[model samples]
Target: MKFWQSVEHAVTPAHGWAATTGAVVAPVFHYFYGTGRADILVVLLVCTALDWVTGIQAAKKQDKTYSSEYGLSRLPRTMFFLALPALANLLDRVMATPGFLFYGVTFGLIYHTWNSLTANAHRAGWPVPKAIVNLVETEIKAKTERAMKQKEGK
Candidate 1:
């Protein structure tokens, strides 16, 4: 108990940042890994890391000052994207929709993952062709708009 208390004291966040993160992520991590679905979590973690790293690289490559302010703005969005699929999966189970919502959301997550990766690549001056970038951007926007319209219709 003393050792645990000492460890807790050492690792505690000044505010609630660390605790909040653990509370949100730990259960998901446990559930996936515990059920031998760790590959899903691993893929997600890898995508998240790559997105952040490339985002930083892009910022440094583009911005003369490279302030952390812009970077901080992305964290909440990243956290939201990371959590969205899991929530959709839970909803699928609750609704008993035969994987429809889960698959749809998972596809969206993966599409957005690649889209972000492509954007980061372009921003980092990776020679992404203008035509391909435009095409993908247009398609993604259309798809997103369709989803929004459908949601509104419901």
Candidate 2:
């Protein structure tokens, strides 16, 4: 009976892959987030996904070019930025610091990504607030100025 059960279990196929994967990942997630940080991760992921979908729509509408290759080329950067919160969490652990840097940088990235998503949505013909768009432009201008100054100094 035990041998038959073992064989049955083996042949039944694994429905627990997702569960097993989550179990494996749970420790790593806890190691970084400790607890109560799932919201940050969720927001970042949601923003990234919306941004990509809107990006495709915007490109198709405005540029009339839906190039998967171009999108794929940009994917690494998108993924890296998306993963910055994990780096922040790791930094908090290793440096024995308060999680301010983690929250600050991650929330900032989330905001920036959401802003991009909104811009893409607006371009794709959705009505986004003018103020929101203006804010994005202002931030870009400030960043550009800072970068220009750095270039000049160099």
Candidate 3:
């Protein structure tokens, strides 16, 4: 084959795969995040990356080896984080409460991740104020309890 034909042949399969993946993902993404809200996912991913990096640094500071196996464990955690907001979005739709559950769950997860990141930062030798840590802990606990009570009431 000629050079341009060879290049096209190589790229054609990749283009097909990209189109197929986009087709499968687009609707699900739109359903979960709604239109023009990809920034929510981007923020979640960025926060997750920061947490992972800080966790690795903390492990190093503590003279512990952060293995790839442990890093791989984060996949499930990240999936849970993503799935929770999707579920909340569904709940919001069911209740006809425009974006309330979705945004609440997403922001809650982000706040929790922020807490984890701050703790990791402290472990990695950056000092975080105790009051801020306490407040975060309290908020998380309150939210958890409220969720549990709501579940029980239902």
lDDT, candidate 3, 18-102, per-residue tens: 9999999999888977666689868887988988887778766753555677679779988888898888888888999988988
Q: What 10-residue stretch in candidate 3 is worst by lDDT?
A: 139-148
Q: Show where candidate 3 strays beyond 4 Å.
A: 1-11, 63-72, 126-154
Instruction: Give lDDT: candidate 2, residue 6.
Output: 90
lDDT of 2 by residue, 1-154 (tens): 9999997777643646867888999998877665788887888889989989987887677556666776898789987886677788788888987687789888898888887787777667778888887867755455345435644554
Predicted structure with the largest TM-score when compared to the true one: 2
- Using all chains and alpha carbons, the TM-scores for the candidates as numbered come to 0.58, 0.75, 0.69
Q: Give the C-alpha miss distance for residue 5 in model 1, angstroms.
A: 30
lDDT of each: 0.66, 0.76, 0.76
| Residue 104 accuracy (lDDT) in model 2 | 88
Backbone clashes for every candidate come to 0, 0, 0
